[model samples]
Target: MNQTPQAAIYSPVAQIDALMPDIAAPVDAADFPQTILRFRNDRAAASVGLDSLSDEAWIAHFGRFEPLPGTLPRPLALRYHGHQFRHYNPDIGDGRGFLFAQMRDSDGRLMDLGTKGSGQTPYSRFGDGRLTLKGGVREILATEMLEALGVNTSKTLSIIETGEALERNDEPSPTRGAAMVRLSHSHIRIGSFQRAAFLEDRALLEKLTDYALTHLYGEVPGDNPPAQLLGRVVERTADLAASYMVAGFVHGVLNSDNINVTGESFDYGPWRFTPLWDANFTAAYFDHQGLYAFGRQAEAIHWDVAQLAVSLRALVEAAPLIEQLERFPALYAQAMARRFCWRLGVVPGDGADAMIAAAVRGMAMSGTGIDRFFHDWRGGVAREGHDYDDAAWDAFRGAIAGFAGVEDARRHDYWTDAAPCSMHIEEVEAIWSAIDTDDDWAPLHAKVAAIRRMGAAHSECIAAA
Candidate 1:
């Protein structure tokens, strides 16, 4: 590694050493011959006091999987069993990824540095533990777009292209290889509890709950810490589902292991943004049953929360946990209405829920492109002479007229733009094709810049409000 300036190392994970055995299984990363840095999120790095580190240091820690100073000497491949499409699978764990390191962000919230495609672990069953370059690119796009839309999501911290030819059935054979590191609040999944429950290990279950309560739900107050933590997760998961709907995103995989305990969306696989307001839109081609379809996402999440509640039974009374689980539907509905109104640049008020429903109905009836409609109707006003023969459009116009105009000045400038930053399937393919065919990166860079601008405008709007 090239010598350069380094930041002061900090390790808060040592403070919670007792929780390690119950939640994580230690492992080593696969040794790759090359580590070419492809992407670095300086904005996210600054939050964790890592922006000052040199490129060489970044490649050493994130690419080659060197231990970060003051942190764990060996990486932890977390052990968790999850329900894949409602079927309990105890044979799953971190097959190709591991928890690389842990630290605190500027806000003093504990953050984790988790790797993807780093290497195989004992859980690597019938698969080569690797990640394609295309996969890394897609994750970068997913996180960027979701962040811009104001969703609570894990940020892609670093992506390094490992110079290795890998074969895969999903994409073309002998595809490019890469590794990724994500910055998230926590990696403790609902499956972590599920594993304990499956093993009938009540002690481990309670330990995991206590760890979560202290690390992820410090603000949650109550005599029953387990119930309190469950309540918070329920609320956060509801909001997350609402955000997906408003943003027109489909996660494709809603497996229990994919659902982070902190309720932040991570582990993007086969994810997509819907082209239109179709409730049945499915992201993954293999999801023949549409179990995690666009319209059914809220239901799926509620079911997952219920599963968590079942695991919490190891420590808490069934009645209290069930009460928290029951709050999901109403909380989701309120969140959807509020998020919908915010996207329309309106202050949520009386009849907001009805308006949201009507808007969805109209969009489905007219087959309106979701992103286009939002771009054209932002601020609850259509451009001059714009006309649509749809009930939803009419209802939206009438409802938006009752509220004060958007307070964010940045929004006005954003509205002047001709189109919104969108991540449709065809567009994603085109971006990737450019990289594959001609080694071009301009388009990808341009898209990220546009998305960041939109995010800044939205942030200004929220702050002003």
Candidate 2:
């Protein structure tokens, strides 16, 4: 990694070249007469060697949609088909967004600079390609909270208020507008392969598999490249599902296109963190069928993985693909147990699964705030003021007795805080309401600062361990 004196370590690279029709349907940025710098993620920029750029330069590249030097001059509106709520939708691609640029991070992993609500593209079917300022704020909160909770998720790199008022049926009309950029491991989704399979493009599918294996799954070794890629993705998807469960997150939409190939969670739309443990708690208002409910998230992701397997059949043997598919249940169970224990601040041991089950049932039955419970019971010890009179509490107490200490010493300071960091809907609305009413950004900035503090604490724990 070469680092210039002022610039962060960034190596401009175009790893997604094999996918033909590479140039995104060119669309100009919204002609916003005013561009206000709302947020900039310097930490993320440093990771990709863009921290050296001035705020004016940052706004120029991200806000004004100027091309990053030594990167793709034209953004690529990646083409893919997806299954929306188990119904195959062929008219889906980068409807309101595009892959803006590609570069290598300090660790040499390929990273993507993708946009949301920049402007309309060829795929923007009869819709204005603009993002609400409130929506951008919600995404910033979502990604921050998820990262603090240890989920592999996309980071909101930059947010620029495009200075436009937009009308919407869901929220108050004439809401403020903005554009956002997300930094993530990869933008390739399961739908990427689904599109290839749908077209019966055997050669394109093969090329995509090769590109994915080289850039995203290089460590996956096997004679059959498709099978190897499938296996690795299955493992990652399982881990991702468990992470969402532990984080108490409801992604609202688990469609194939929203499911990333690297297993990292991205695209925050109508997402919510659970207020309590209810299996059927749905995030999206239109999800009346509860297809992607909180309780059904693991199941939903497993179904998406099966769709990916169906797509992979065009490039590999069905037997091997099915063999990889069969491993999902066990993989999910193992990941759940491991991640659940990590959140509870205990080492996994005998009866770990039982403990996890008891905790979940207890929280659901008692309607205990999930985040509060974990914070109160850090190190397997109930805090001094909290009561534990119920049978479930008794079971939980006994379960932790056989385990070791918390994951890291750094977490102790966080536990000392009066309340655990939480992002329930009302709280999120409060943050946004302040901004909307008085143009006061204090609440929003404070919430972000607090969340970053929590993230720094977790990062320290991982680093020390």
Candidate 3:
């Protein structure tokens, strides 16, 4: 009888440590009884011994860890705090999660293999540490979709069901499980500094900042070390904003605790990609005030950056960091412009600015699904039937119908091509109205994938064009 593979297989932490000796600690799994689902990283699994295991065997190894031949493992939780929704919260950080150890990947990169939903830590503030299966699924999907869109993001390494049911407020009862794994970098955050600053631990703040600059932002070059580091981080944050804006993504929660100091998109929450171009669109169901609205995301990021700068003011020379912070709008504009160019399949040049602005204005008033409009525009352009600029200009014209003559022509070719971004502004509202009620994500997943594929192809064509 061909019995299924043995369930003794473990995570790749051992092999990863063996490959890179600089890894700070060893291999040990954090047992998260409430683990919702263990979503394994196929890429990472292949490098470790678990690659030979069967599905059932894989599930058996959910939170198991094998020590590397030459490494020592130390499992510990980090300390930090943040303000949730602009109100200062004196305590927060891995309340339900903990960093198991720092290890080196096969590529010689140092990464933290932490586990969320791994039971309560000292910081667990009135909440269960376990992650729900549905939540894990959402996070995996979000990370996958966002990364494919070319945004710098945190990855979902592994997700598994811990077989322990619990209660929760969001869903029906409590069917809690857990999630596990590692990430590229999980050091400090803007809130990390804030926590230290609040405690008057300037020394710790400086140490943390220095560690971050040397590790994460070391590649960035500038004349003044502090200013250069701040500037690089600002540039990355602005770039993130631009990516979020172009993709119509709303990160429901922008709490400082959720923001990564490494400048990568982290802490998945009630995120939603806008189907239409509504300036007021929000992702979280309870965010009635729209503190993190789709339109306000860029501004919110700037706010987060400013908070970080403020926290480190005493430790570093404030002038340079402030200066970098001042450049937020310009940096965001350039990134957004570049992204828009890619989406529209236009080459980088002068005058595209006016056309993009016009297109956005058209989208805002015309009530079209932002994703569909761009996809249709590119599809139309690729088919070689109508002038792309003309279609976009017509869509623009429909918004402000009084304009006429050469002004319209100039707008059409302001970027390139000859058609508008969309053919019909007439039926845009109808499209949005139809999808507004249905939150069943299966169809939306297929649609989002198609949209991303189209965007990628359009980007390639633009680069080549």
User: Whose lDDT is greatest here?
Assistant: 2
Model 1: how far residue 449 lies from native, Å: 0.8
Model 2, 90-198: lDDT tens per residue?
Answer: 8888877888889887778889999998888888898898899999999999988998888889989998998889999999989999999999999999998898899
TM-score of each: 0.95, 0.95, 0.75
Off by over 4 Å in 2: 1-8, 22-27, 407-411, 462-465
Positional deviation of residue 333's Cα in model 1 after best superposition, in angstroms: 1.2
Worst 10 residues of 1 by lDDT: 1-10
What do the candidate models score in CA lDDT, each in turn? 0.83, 0.83, 0.59
Q: What would the per-residue lDDT of candidate 1 be over residues 53-129, giving only the tens digit for each residue?
A: 79999999999888888877889888899999999999999998998888887767888899899988888897678
Q: Model 2 — TM-score against the truth?
A: 0.95
Give lDDT tens digits, candidate 3, residues 150-178. 56666566777676677887665555465
For each candidate, how many residue pairs have backbone atoms clashing (under 3 Å)? Answer: 0, 2, 34
Q: Which stretches of candidate 3 lie over 4 Å from their true place?
A: 1-38, 43-62, 65-72, 101-109, 219-225, 379-465
